[model samples]
Target: MSTSRHPLRGDVLGEQPEAMAAFWRLYGLLWSHGTVDQSIKEIARLRNARTTDCAYCRNVRFAGARDDGLTEDRVALIEDGYETSTLTEREKAVIRYVDTFLHDPAGLTDTQRAELLEHFTPGQLVELTAGVALFLGFSKIAVALGPPPGMPTLVVPTPDWAPGEAQP
Candidate 1:
């Protein structure tokens, strides 16, 4: 892992601090009151990372997904659809919605909205949407910074192997 933080700290802090702070404040609100499932939150983050192609977020969320009890096969299935697998129907619905939200949020249909409503309260939906948007912003920041000079880029595991293990 690299010790270097964001390369464009000045821009991120000076030009974007207020916006970022708003996101953090929203996060605090969600944490304080939201009833969103932790697993659903992790799945949303993982999908967001995959959509953004952000290595940092992907790596971080891969570990988090595992910690949340998503098996290797289940995590792999998320890239496609995990509904046919062992995930609960609610979990499947959340992952499906996250995929659609990240890929085509502007095109979200009534059906998608209904699916979310079925599984989450209005406050939880707001919190989930806010979280997805926040991660999207963070991923852009990470990619723009371009890792660090001379640091080896870390690769996120692709779910066939245990995280942190060398594939044989």
Candidate 2:
């Protein structure tokens, strides 16, 4: 279905106003709370969106990232090769943590935690951790329910084959 035609208007917010309110309440705090760099948070957010194949998540513009001092060049490199890109070691560490968290939460090791500690305070770590978990759930919801009607995105993905197709 077109995202606009989604049953729940594509956004859980419209169907479950209370839940969205609670979600945004927490999300608002995570956006600028704690000592973890805003740039790191943006990178983590973008990385989660890309890994989940949620076009809606990917399409939302992150003005915050730019405001946090990330250059367009750095933001552009987030999709594929961020590990080897021009990002600093600290930024790369945040990406690695988010990647591992999304793919395998239990796989996070003390070594990785220690690395994060080198850069983030204990409170910042909590904030970053919560943000990662929130987006993990958020991206899944967006992928399943699709974007809300009239929501803007950079580009929406198209499937190669429809639901029914003749055998090759």
Best by the TM-score measure: 2
Quote each prediction's TM-score: 0.65, 0.78
> Pairs clashing in candidate 1?
none
lDDT string, candidate 2, 19-80, tens digits: 66566556665674446666788788788988987777776655566667866677788866
In model 2, the worst 10-residue window by lDDT is: 159-168
Backbone clash count for every predicted candidate, in the order shown: 0, 0
RMSD of each: 9.5, 11.4
Q: What tens-digit string does per-residue lDDT give for candidate 1 at 33-108?
A: 4577556776777777788887766665434345557655665666764667777777777777777777776887
